[model samples]
Target: MPADRPYDRRRLLRDAAVGAAAVSTAGLATGVPARAAAPAPAGAPITAARARRSGAVSFRWWGTAGWRIDIGDRTVLVDPYLSRYDTGLFTGRFNPDTPLTVDAARIDPLVDRAENILVTHTHWDHFNDVPHIAVRTGARVVGTLTAYHLGLAYGLPAGRLAPVKGGEVLDFGDYTVEVVSSLHSRNGSWSLAFPGVRVSPPPRPEKISDLPEGDTLAYQIRVAGGPSVFFTGASDLNERNLTGLTPDVAMVASAATTSTADYVPRLMAALDHPKIVVPVHWDNFETPLTNPPTVAASDRERLDDLIAAVRKASPRSRVLLPEYHTAYHF
Candidate 1:
């Protein structure tokens, strides 16, 4: 079960009374707080200012699996990997023992507003920029103990690191997030296979490969009086763990391979068929953000197959393909 309500009864009652009084003063019988009011109905024309003022939830894709989610005044970043390291340079010669330089300047722009950083795993592409982003934005880092240790190794402030092994619900004033245990996408023949890093005393690795794939996590984020979004950084999912979560939006990964060919349908059913399906992590990460995103030839077939499967399994749901750095209002 989640933690008990963090508010006292008297405080709740007083807040309700104050809200009512404000509504009365504004001559509105709807009893909705001016700042907490809903935006125009779905499909209705709404400006960015109106949406923000109305406390509407918005999401901006930053290529790869990175996303900036804004719910009212709060902001949360998921699997932010904006530092597009030139992996090709390392190629067959890359080694875990070698030190890799991180360019924080490459990550600063996309993370200016992040209040919280949610990491799904410790894979390089998913976590390399996290420590720098946390340092730059003064955001709290949430992930498994492995990720926490990695943060420690990276010199991240202790006060900003939150280690959890899933099944934890966190309240951040404007929204509540539930961390659910999840599986990583299939890597070649082995399912959920990756080197596990359990460094004690925190070696403080300076190489990209030093960060191994820690426990994977999926997030179910519910914004206050707004939309709920479920995001998975990996292509695979644990259906049993996601049984009753029916988020309004599902940010599904479409690039990597999955455990089985029926992964898409199973994922949709597991999520209880979300109303909006957005395919993420489908673009090539090796390329810089300056270049228009292009679906890798190897991933194109699987991406198309996933989209087709989603359409077939959940015909009523809308498939939204988000562009790089573009904000999608929900």
Candidate 2:
């Protein structure tokens, strides 16, 4: 099992968790800190869509901690739990719905055309509607063993869903994807938080019949010419996790509650890969507040704390605090 609580791990994870003190570029700007891009070759601005597609990876946020990546001509959607389900899911547990402002509809188009869907885990908010999507879009689903099984449970064919083991890669004709591991608990169902508070309540004691909710997971995908992208669903940073891959861009969960709050420094440290850092799993829910076992106020404060820590550790990396519906090129 992972350490009961992180120790040196904490110290390392906090590399990006520097307090509000001034960061010393200290001449390392040329190193992992800042890499100057070569001058853009002058060319007529062609069709913007073609320009956008020319990028090695086209990434966009689809609410929550989910992302859409287009590698060359292959399109991959990760952890899309798009729903305006009841807010009662988060009310009293996490932070309140203080969204960073992005449209969900814009994300809908991408989902409709996704060629492949990879769920990092099985959380309702991450895997929702995915089964139907796979059926509708003819997209293959790849993820952790459990994720593949979860898709199977939703009526997906065994052939359409591939169970990925860490260190292995799945090729989609246009690109490749790899499944990674994480130390998150699924025995405990997934829950939402509202500003260090519970914005919603839990299912009735009787309705608690649904087995544990979801598990967290990580992923690595490589496109023909794009740098590899690493995505962590959520977990306490583990050294064993940094294996078999070099991430050119990494996306990790930043749910402002117990898990994210406690492990920010450590997790980020283990992911000290020099690349683009994208934040996911923030404060956003569509349901009305009315649930049990909600977030205890203490957990809500974790989000702000994690963000602060990241500011310190990764001042060198471009931090993308994405809006729900915008596209980013990597």
Candidate 3:
């Protein structure tokens, strides 16, 4: 909390309560704001956007484990993978030669004015195509050491890349970011199922390491006007491990065997019980992924269940699981 922080617990409770109501309205009609917020601020405002959120705060899910968190003047993308996931873009085959083929055209507008891109790990889906965006926009690439170099391979200057170790923090124009520890897994496919339905994931590269992605990381961004947002790259939440942090919003992963309602319940019960939540790492592939299994409609249904569970687990928490490119203001 390096920033001279403002923690108005009452405002947070009110926003979460009100935001949930608005999101429910918007969710039902796809346009309703349970309640309207103030007008939006122009891009790159000299001073930080206020906590009042005069404009909107939204989460746009772009298949795979990606999200564009739009908070008025500044837009932030987290572990984005907008392309068809199975297109070898994730394997080393695509990166070393093909240049992570994303639906860049779709990505362009989402990141139209993004000042920072948070890379959760060096995994292909999270970090690969980002450098392409960074080089084109000169946006800062924030992640681990390997991610920093991988960015260089994609033609971005080292200066534009900011390497962050776990448990560290960085400063954005009007916000602060805290890096969370990530428990990364190898890329091999494993057995998975949903409601007794079974499928296998695609063939994955031989694991390069086994320490749960030494460089895998999560982030907590404390912005001026909004609540504190926490992002989980890909992890199995351990209350013992994350007990130290208090996050108002969490972006957790639910793919493969991890899509079960059980997997998320325990995790949510242990955390600070965020006011808002978003699910990632599900339904992000070109076709049926070839080991265990990948994101599918069952997974989506499971996601539906996860949302329901979140509501039950934290009655006050507002759940936001948006479709690709959809916008929300909270």
Q: Model-by-model lDDT, in order?
A: 0.67, 0.51, 0.54
Kindly list the per-residue Cα lDDT of model 3 for residues 45-136, writing each as its tens digit: 54346523454555565655666766666667787655443433222122222334556765665556667888876555565557667766
Top-TM-score structure, candidate number: 1
TM-score of each: 0.79, 0.65, 0.68
In candidate 3, stretches whose alpha carbon ends up further than 4 angstroms from where it belongs are: 1-46, 85-99, 185-214, 258-262, 287-295, 308-312
CA error at residue 125 for candidate 3, angstroms: 2.1
Q: Is candidate 1 or 2 superior in TM-score? A: 1
Predict model 2's lDDT versus the native: 0.51
Query: Per-residue lDDT for 1-330 in model 2, tens only?
Result: 133322222211111222222123332222243222222223443332453345434676665556766554456788765554542333332222322222345345545566778776554555555776787688888766655655655667889886665666676655677766664421112232110211122231111112122444577776655567787665444556775466777776654334333465555566664466665554343421122111223334444455566667765565554444445666
Model 2 per-residue lDDT at 105? 56
Worst 10 residues of 3 by lDDT: 9-18
Q: After superposition, how far is residue 84 of candidate 2 from its true place, in Å?
A: 3.0
What candidate 2 gets wrong by more than 4 Å, as runs, is: 1-53, 93-110, 185-215, 255-262, 287-301
CA RMSD for every model?
15.2, 10.4, 12.5
